[model samples]
Target: MKFFAGAAVLLLLFALAPFASVPAGHRGVMTTFGNPSDQVLSEGIHFRVPLAQKLNLVNVSIQKGEGEGDAASRDLQTVHTRIALNYHVKPEGAVSVFRDLGNEPGERIIIPAVQEAVKAVTARFTAEELIAKRTDVRDQIIAQLRERLARHAIVVDEFSIVNFNFSKSFNDAIEAKTTAEQLKLKAERDLQRIEVEAKQRVAQARAEAESLAIQRQQVTPELIRLREMENQRMAIDKWDGKLPNVAGGAVPFINVK
Candidate 1:
């Protein structure tokens, strides 16, 4: 009678156990006798065998991660880069994620993947190209990260390069090169302006010389004789229609030849 009563009380306790509730944005993984089952339980109240099964909740929401590391560019220049990423566990792969990475997957997996991806992509580009082709570099890194993380059932949603740092020498070289280019451009423009001004001056001198030549070509013996006759007529008109008082023969003093 004692054994029967104890067994009945145990049965009632197990039957009256509370149902497991998986929270929002989480999926439930059931483990039977310390071994996880392939079946995933959706978010809601679930029933499991008492003492034989346990329910573990895995979050599937997006998460942000940041990492920084140093690498070498293709040109052998040292580069330090900080990167950020947005990712989430694959909903269907929750079982695999739980079995493989457990909790704190970001530190265990995502950060290392980011570091590796950054190094791999940076090596393919020179320091200058890294600055110029930033979009391409980011895309390549994203691709590599996706390929690497997918095996672990981690999905990468987005990736970005937060910043890139280079050696002081490289930065100084870039600045000097930019200044030299600006100076060269200014010099070329000045030379062009000077050439244009010189040509304008030459054209003005040529025009004046041509005008003088044309005037010389128009001067002939007929024109010279016409000028002398015009001057004699002018002297006759200015006379008071009377000869000078002391003239010996009262002759007209006009050169009309």
Candidate 2:
């Protein structure tokens, strides 16, 4: 009876050995005799042969990592770049990544692979192009990295440049140039306003001179005689405590004192 009890206990222990739980967004790769199997285990409780088979849990959820890149400007100046990357394993390719790349390959392969791809692609573009045409450059990096790392089951999710640094002197020079251009534009506007005002003044002066010339042309002998009589009347009104002896000609004058 004791021998039968011992045999039953051994069977129970063997049955309970090496069962694994795969969490949400996780997959399991089973390796036997140091060879990864083609079959894949998904989330939830899983059982594997205790000694020969091993379960390696991989998070199949979308994940992200960040790295740095460096390059030169169009003028051959240095630039430093910070990059953020998103990644996920292909459902069908998870086991292959496990076999070729080691378990938990976050920094060991994914980060380096992304960094390499970034540098490779960024080298083709200057720092200014990387900044101005950032979207295109980022897309190129994503494409190249995805192609290269997919063989290792590290799929490129999305990648972008977080920040970049250029030479301080270059930035300052650009700002100065922009300021000078603005000043030049303002000066041109001021010159244009001055020119317009001067033209208006000249036009006004010419208009007044033309009005005086028209008055002169309309004058005849009748108008001149009438003006002379009006001037004599005004001179008589201005006389005060003064007398003038007039030689009588066509018009007779009487002296009153």
Candidate 3:
């Protein structure tokens, strides 16, 4: 009787072996003898053939992948770029993703796609434009990645360029060019100020010369006679009505003429 009870328990265990649990944020792909099916199992207890069937869980939640590569710019400058991508498997396409790309889609598809997309986009811009028009470059790369990844049923939620590295010589050249432009601007301002001051000095000198010329023109013989009469009156006003007591008696002049 005990042996029969153990056998009954074994049969019950075998009966429950086909039912599998799929966790949240994941989908189950049913495969028959190593072949995937189009039917995607939603997150719950699922039923499959006991020995001939398998359940493959594909996480449909957002995942992050990173990639880096050295590429050449449009101007032939070498660029080392690193990027991050947030993506997920399409819930409806879990079967195809598992069948075609297997379990590691990030390694098989996402990283390679990122590298290729970055190379394709970077080739359209120079190294300087990569820094100046960084937004455009990043958008183009994201668009390219979305297009490339959609075919594999990998949806791109977000993409970003983490860092861009260039040659030391390029950086130095940029710095030197900036310094030279600043110095040139300063010299231009200084020249403008000097020219303005020189113009003011020339104008002042011309004004003083014009005033002197006008005063000389106003001086005539009548003006000179008037000045002499004025001086004689000033001398008489100061006299005490007495002549000098010298050997030669000198009298003060009273220009009556």
Which regions of candidate 2 fall more than 4 Å away from where they truly are?
1-18, 195-257
For model 1 the local lDDT of residue 218 reads 100
What would the per-residue lDDT of candidate 1 be over residues 1-257, giving only the tens digit for each residue? Answer: 99999999988877856368888888889998889999878889998887788899888889888888999999999999998899998878888888888756787788888888899999999999999999999999999999999998889998899999999999999999999999999999999999999999999999999999999999999999999999999998997877566747656567579
Q: For residue 56, what is the lDDT in candidate 1?
A: 92
Compared with the true structure, the alpha-carbon lDDT of candidate 2 equals 0.79
Error of 1 at 220 (Å): 3.0
After superposition on all CA atoms, what RMSD does each candidate show versus the true structure?
5.9, 5.6, 4.6
Q: Which one wins by TM-score: 2 or 3?
A: 3
Report the number of clashing residue pairs per model. Answer: 0, 0, 0
Stretches of model 1 off by over 4 angstroms after superposition? 1-17, 224-257
TM-score of each: 0.78, 0.73, 0.76
* Tens-digit lDDT track of model 2 for 1-257: 99999999999977867687777887888888678888888888887787888888777788888777676655576778898888888777778767766766676688777777766777777655776898888788788888878777777777888987778987787689779999999999999999999999999999999999999999999999999999999988888845455676543445659
Q: Give the winner by TM-score: 1 or 3.
A: 1
The TM-score measured for candidate 2 stands at 0.73
10 residues in a row with least lDDT, candidate 2: 244-253
